[model samples]
Structure formats: C-alpha cells, structure tokens
Target: MFGIYIHIPFCRKACHYCDFHFSTSLNYMDEMVDAICKEIALKADRVSGTAGSIYFGGGTPSILPATALQKIFQTLEKHFDIATGAEITLEANPDDLNAAALKTMRALPVNRFSIGVQSFFEEDLRWMNRAHHAGEAIDSIRRSQDAGFENLSIDLIYGYPLLSDEKWESNLATAISLQVPHLSSYSLTVEPRTALAAAIEKRKEPAPTDAQSAEQFRMLMARLQSARFEHYEISNFALPGQYAVHNTNYWRGVPYLGIGPSAHGFDGHTRYMNMASNATYMQALLRGQLAEERELLTDHDRYNEYVMTSLRTMWGLDPELVISRFGRSYHDYLHTALGKLGSNDWLISGDGKIKLTTEGKLYADHIASELFKVDEE
Candidate 1:
C-alpha cells in the first residue's frame, strides 16, 4: 500500500550536524501548516488506493501544537482513504514531549513516536546542540510510555567526537532498559556546509574517524543482537513485529506522497522533489501550484536504487527477480560485478538471494556502488 509523508520544516534550535531543510524561526508556522494542508489536498489524486502509513517527519513535528497537527490530520482524512489501523508516526524532539504536549499528541491519530534522543549524556547533547538535556531524554520516553504511546522508536547517533565506546554502550543499555520497541541509530557524518563541518575545518571540533565509527558499529550490532532486536536494516534495530511501517514501505519502493517544503515523493518510475526554500513552497501553494521537480527514472536508476536499499536489509537481493523485472541484461551485469568482487568475505549467497555479512555492512555503500549498473543500455 502507498504511504503519506508530511515534512514539518520548523525547529526550535538548529542542531550543529543537521543540513536538512528547516528554519529555526516559527514566524511562518501557521502559514506553513496551511500550505502543507493545501498541498495534501492538491495532490490527493496521485495515489489511487488507501494509505497504509502516514509519517510526520521534520525539523521537529512535535514543535507544532496539537491544533495545527489536528487540522492537518483532518485534511488528510478528508482527501485520502487512510487504511484502518494505519501506522501514523510523529518524529518528536525530547524537550517537546512534556506532559501537556504528550496529552495533546494523544488526541491526534498518531500511534507511534520517534523521539530524537541522540544521546543520554549532557556533554554529548550539548556538543550536538540538541535542545534537550540528558534528563529530558530519559523522561520523554517514560512520559510518552506513561501517556500510553508504546509503539515508540528512538534515534541515537554514534561516531561523534565526544561519544566514547563506553558511552555508546551506556546509550544502548539505557535504551534497552527503557524497553522501547525500535531503535534507529546512525554515524555522525560531517555534511558539507553544516555547522559541524565548518567547525571541523576551523579546528574547533574534531572530525569523526572512520575507524571509530566502524568499531562502535560492531559494538552496536553485537549488543542489539543479544537484546533480541533484529538488525532488519543497516541502521535500524527492532523487536519482533516492531518494524517501522512507513520507513519499511520507503525502502521497499512503495509509492508515497510527500507534502511540504524539501519533501520528496516517488511512484516507482518517477521521483518528485519539492523546492527546499520555505517561502517558495508556500508561495506556490498559495497560487494553487506545486513547486516541485519531477524526474522519470531510467532502468539504470531503478536498478541502482533497488540494490542500494535492498542490500542494507535482512531480506537481501534476489537476482532472479532482478532478471524478471529489470531484464536479463541487468542481471548479467550484476553477475559480472559479483565475479569482480572475488574472494571478498563481505557477501553470502544462498536461497537465491545475496546478502551482506556483518563485516560487509561497514562497506555497504562501496559494495552497492561496485554492483551498480552505471552506463546506459
């Protein structure tokens, strides 16, 4: 089934490492919400059937008040046939999940909360410029749980300068103790033009090292595996039956409608990217138009996308399906690439699927790139 994604582009504070399209100002909150609702109504006919998942992702979806969120939900229900028991997720920051906030969120259709608790230490939070402290991080989860929102996921970041191995272990242990069903963790990469990258260039902050990231990732896998969490995707761990429906739909190439500035939508064969500028996005919607660019995907694009995403999951890649869907030429190309990999212990092939070994995950990007069919037909 298709999915719906709404991008909330406002945040209270800008995290140092974030380069995602967002504004620290809330001046246009009402107008932005209006524009998002309008966009949703305007694009309602794009997806034919029911939506199985609705994800509210952003600079901080929790930054919006319940009224604004409720209005958006109203618009969605009006235009789309959202499936019964659809997984509705809101990505919230720790500091915004107070008692009043949690109460309001429960009033909406949101059944899942993905809290951005990047670390459990004050120093790490401060270093990353997170809006919440260590206490709020723990309290937010407990508060949300108390509010009867148990379908919860928390994000944790590793490979940053201040995150030691011992500290990483502590972070994992704390999350396990909280009994949250899902975890999405990632390495802190310094994206160009972000505050973190600028600091690194000026020698004000130490850059994250590859070796450190690799070692910590190993620790993450072992610890989570023992805790009965499935490493279903490269950076995602979840208890049984707790996988995130929205993100899983994304990886499996389920078509979705993305609403709001800097959001993206895909319909199997094409991609739509919204304008990153908030003003531009709102202006277009005000004029009853969408400020987005659409690209028709080539076979090359589809093949690479499938390989990149499917290889990172426990499901692995099926060569025969590739042959059936993308044609024999593409499958032949993949076979040739595999031969070139030679004696590398990074991949295992069985049951007509090729999957990455634990060591191979460290080089997931490299491996996918090597397997990519780059040239034209």
Candidate 2:
C-alpha cells in the first residue's frame, strides 16, 4: 500500500545536532500550512490507491497548532482514500505533549506519536540544545499513555561523547520501562556546517568515536533483544506487530507521496524531492506549480537501492529476486561481491536470503555500497 508524508519545517528551537531543513522562525507558518494543503491537492492524481499510513514528520510537527493540523487533515480527507485502520503518526517533542495539547490531539485523526526523546537526561538534552528537560521527557511518555496513544515510538540517540555507557544504559532501561511499542535509535553523525560540526572544529565538543558508537550499538541490540524488542531494522526495535507500517512500506520501495518543503516521494520508477526553502516552496505552490525535482531510476539505481535497504532490515536481501527482477547479471555480480564483505561468517544464508549477523550491522552501509551495481557500458 502507498504512504503519505507531510513535512512540517518549523521548530521552536534549533537542536545542535540537526541538519534537517527547518527554520526556527514561525514567520511563514500560516502560509506554509496553506501551501502544503495546496500541494496535497496538486499531487493527488499522481498517487494511486488508499494510503495505509500518513506520517506527519518534521522540524517538530507537534509544534504546529491543533487548528493547523486539523486543516491539513481535512484536506487529506477530501483528496484520497485513507485506509480505515491507517497508521497516522505525528513526530512530537516532549515539551509539546502537555495535558491540553494531548487532549486536542486526541480529537484529531493522528493515532500514533513518535516522540523525539533524544535522551532522558538533563545534560544530554542541554548539550543537544533540546527544548525539553529530563522530567518532561519521562512525564510526556506516561502522559501520552494516559492519553491513550499505544502505537507509540520514541527516538533515542547514541555515539556522542556526552552520552556515556552508563547513560546509554539508563536510556534503554527507561525506554523498556515505559513499554513504548516502537523505538528508533541512531548514532550521532556530525553533518557539515551544523552546530555540532562547528562545535567539534572549535574544540567545544568531543568528536564521536567509532569505538564508542559501535559499543553503544551492541549495547542497544543486547538490551532491546532481551527486552523482547525485535531488531526489525538496524536502527529500529519494536514489540511484535508494532513495526512502523509507513517506514516498512518505504523500505520495501512502496510508492508514497510527500508534500511540503524538504519532503521526498517515491513512485516506483521515479523519486522526487521538494526544494528545501519554505519561501520558495510556498511561492511556487501559490503560483500553481509543483516545487520538486525528479530522478528516473535506472535498473542499476533500483537494484542498488534494493540491496542497500533490504540488507539493513531483518528480511535481508534475496538472490532469487535479484535474478528474476534485476536479471541474472546482477545476481552473479552479488555473489562475486560477497567476497568484499570478508568471510561468510557475518552473513547467513537461509531460504535464499542473505541476512547480516548483528556484528555485520555495524558495517551495513559499507557492505551495501560494496555490492552496488555499476551501470553497464
């Protein structure tokens, strides 16, 4: 089934580690809402079938007003067929989930909350320049549960100097205790020109170490697995039946439509992304134009994308699918390149699927790129 993504590009504060396209300014919030609604109408025909999931992600989607969210939801209702049991997720921050806010949200169509609980510690929150405190992080989860949001996910971060092994352990323990259905964790990566990168250059913060990140990841796997959380995707852990439908569809290369500045869409053959500028996106949409760029995928592009995504998931990559879908040439290339991953010790073969061992996941990106297809001459 197809999915829909709406990017909200405004946040109350700019997190130090974020390089996502967002603005701290709310100067154009109303205009942006209008433009996004216009865009949903604009691209309705390009998408096919009922949406199984609709994800409102962002620069803090929870920061938007209840009225604004409702307006967007109303627009969606008028445009497409949304599945009755569709998974609707809103990426919310801790500070935004007070009682009144949660009350208003309950009335809205959103059924899931993906809380941005980067770390449930005071120092980590302050270091990352997050707007929430440790207490709010803890309280927010309980409060949301009281508000009846069971389809929940909280994001945690590892691999930063500020996050010690003990602190990382505390974070996982907190996540398990909360009993949130889903968890998405990632190692901190310093993006160029971001505050974290600048801080590292100026010796304000210690650079993230590969050793620290790897250790933390291993800790995460053991903790989550013992906690009975399925390591579904490399960075994602969930209780059984709680896998994120939207993202699972995305990983499986299902077609989706994205509307808003800095949003991306895939329609099987072509992938498109909107211009990142809020002003530019609004201006173009006001003029009845689609503000996006497109790339038509070649077989090489498609195969490489498949290998990269599939390998990162628990399902792994299928050699037979490569032979049938991408032809025998790609299948042969895959077997030949399996040597680059070193011994088959880290790779296990069962049911014709090449899945990575937990040890192999630390090098997943490198491994996937090693198996990438070069366009034939």
Candidate 3:
C-alpha cells in the first residue's frame, strides 16, 4: 500500500509564480533520469510491500521523451513489485500532449493523467508565462479523453491578479464540460523570491488581494458542490470513487518513497529530502551516496504533522489511533484542545472522529496550530 513519486526537474518554460524546484534547461535530462533510476534502486529497501500507486510529478513530466519515460517505468517495474492495477499518474503540460504522444502513453501501464491546465484564457496564460495556450488546454483534454483516459484530472489556479471572477467561473465550467473526474485547484500565492513576487515589488505586476482570493474560493466551493463534486480535501475535488489514492495515502501518514532531485520521502516517523541541486545529486549518486537530508521526528513533531494533514481532509483526526501511537498523555492533550475548539464550534466530535465544519476549514491551519503540542521551555 506504499506509493512512489518520481520528480522530473526539467520544464520547457518557467511559470512566474512557481516555486517548485525545476530547471528550464533540458541539458541534464538524460543524466537526471539516470540518477533518478539509480536513486530508486538505492532506496528500494525502504518500503516493505508492493506499490499501490506510482506518480510521475515534475517540472513537467510530460516534457520527457516517450522513450525516456518508458525506460524509467521499466526500471521501476524491474526493481519493485508494482500492483497489477496500480494507479499510475503522470503530471503533464498541455503543449506536450498530442495524439501520437497520448497513444504512446496509453500503451504503457499509466492509468491516470493529471494535466496542468491552469486556465482556459490566453491572457492568464501569458501573465503566468505558461508554455501552452488556452486552446491547447481544451484540445489536450479532449484528445486525452478520445485516447481512452477516463481517469483524468486537471489542475486549475484561481485568485491570480489577472483572473477575473468571470474567468475563474469559466475555468471551472470548462473542466466540468470536459467531464474530468478529478481536479486539483489552487489559489495563487506570491511566494517570496519568485518572479511573481519580484514583479509585484517592481510594479510590473499587480499583487493578489486576500479579499479577492477568499471570494473566489467561496465561489469555487459553491460551484463545485452544486456540480456534485466532493470537496474531499481543501484544494481537491473528485467524482465518486475518483479520489487520488496517491495523495490520499500521504495525507493518512502512509509511507512513500520519492525519487529525483529535491524529492521527499517519508516513513511514519522519519523524513528525507534529496539535494535540490541537480549536479550535486548526480555526483553524490555516482559516488554511491544518497545526497539527501534526513530528520528524526520527535513525538511533538509527529503529533503536529498528523493534525496538520488530517484536519485538511474529510477523514479528520482519529482519537483512538492517536492514543495508541502517541501516548495517553498526548491523547489527553488532544481532548483538551478539542474541547476548546468544540466550544467555539470550530470542531465537531462524534463517533471517535473529529472533523471541521465549512467555517472551520477557513482557519484550518490556525486550529491545527492551537492543537499542536508545544515543547517544554
């Protein structure tokens, strides 16, 4: 029931707001892919059982040449016991998708395709410096469906300074019209040191407003709910039985192995992150070293991690699991914190499960922080 995530750190173009570790250059793609395969082989013993899901995420996984992708998949199959019906997902950009490319993808065992279609408006695409056009976004999904990819997901972004509320509505309507089974929507945040932030400081671009973003989020929830899509997580919507098993496992604290530069891996108690520099990662791997940093979790850190992730999902936190894994004292601390929030109507406890109402979801992080176990001074 473990999952595998492969990070392809190369993209054709850099989006202004993206803070994810990725390079616009493809010069090191071959070496990087080789290094990823080596890393996978080196870390094979970390997870004990067969893989239930394998996700190819990235700078843009679709940018990989089909031959290269096939090689990576073949290498993984060689080293791991991938389940026969495993959910294999590839995060792709619209420009890289074509009839022939999709046909090749279908031939492989990949069953899910998560297409990056941030907007269906050319102006927004230009503002974001995305590599594809608005037309390509629609065409890509249409072609994917025609190519027999029923389990499809599309990524959408709202709250951009340039995205009007009307445009945001149009974007969701477009996805619904395409009949996409799953969606991963996000609010645009200006990360420090990214081009988007720089542009705002330089007066070259307008900054995103909190009020606008909040309104758009409210609109998103209402529209998606009306369409009968389940708001299973803070930023995800899916049709029945279409939730992303890979991401769901991560939220539930399931162990997973992540490969490639800047990738992260987590067992229940420990976490590892690969070096962000491509050259350093490859060099270290060549020397038979895992170029990664590791952190040993403290009891407080584990409790905080569970609260942060579980609160964002529909499943909420389980008191019984916490008491068994953490301790009676930790469990008692949770009850105390729950009592405070429950009185505030931010949390509802029933059937041994604690869940947040719609009002509570707005301050989910704040609530989780209040429940966090602070270390003794």
Q: Give me the candidate number with maximum lDDT.
A: 1
Compared with the true structure, what per-residue lDDT tens digits does model 2 show for residues 76-166? Answer: 9999999998999999999999999999999999999999999999999999999999999989999999999888999999999988899
lDDT of 3 by residue, 1-377 (tens): 89999889999998999999999989988888888888988998898889999999988999998888888988998899999899999999998889989989877888999999999999999989999999999999999989998899999999988888998999889899999999999999999989999999999988898788888988888898888899889899998889999999989989999899999999888899999889999999888889999999999999899989998988889988898889899999998987776567677777778888777777788999989999867
lDDT of each: 0.95, 0.94, 0.90
Ranking by lDDT: 1, 2, 3
**Model 3 clash number:** 0
CA lDDT of 165 in candidate 2?
97
Which portions of model 2 show Cα errors greater than 4 Å?
A: none
Q: TM-scores of all models?
A: 0.99, 0.98, 0.97
Segments of candidate 1 deviating more than 4 angstroms: none
Residues 89-179 of candidate 1 have per-residue lDDT tens digits of 9999999999999888877899999999999999999988999999999999999999999999999999998998999999999999999
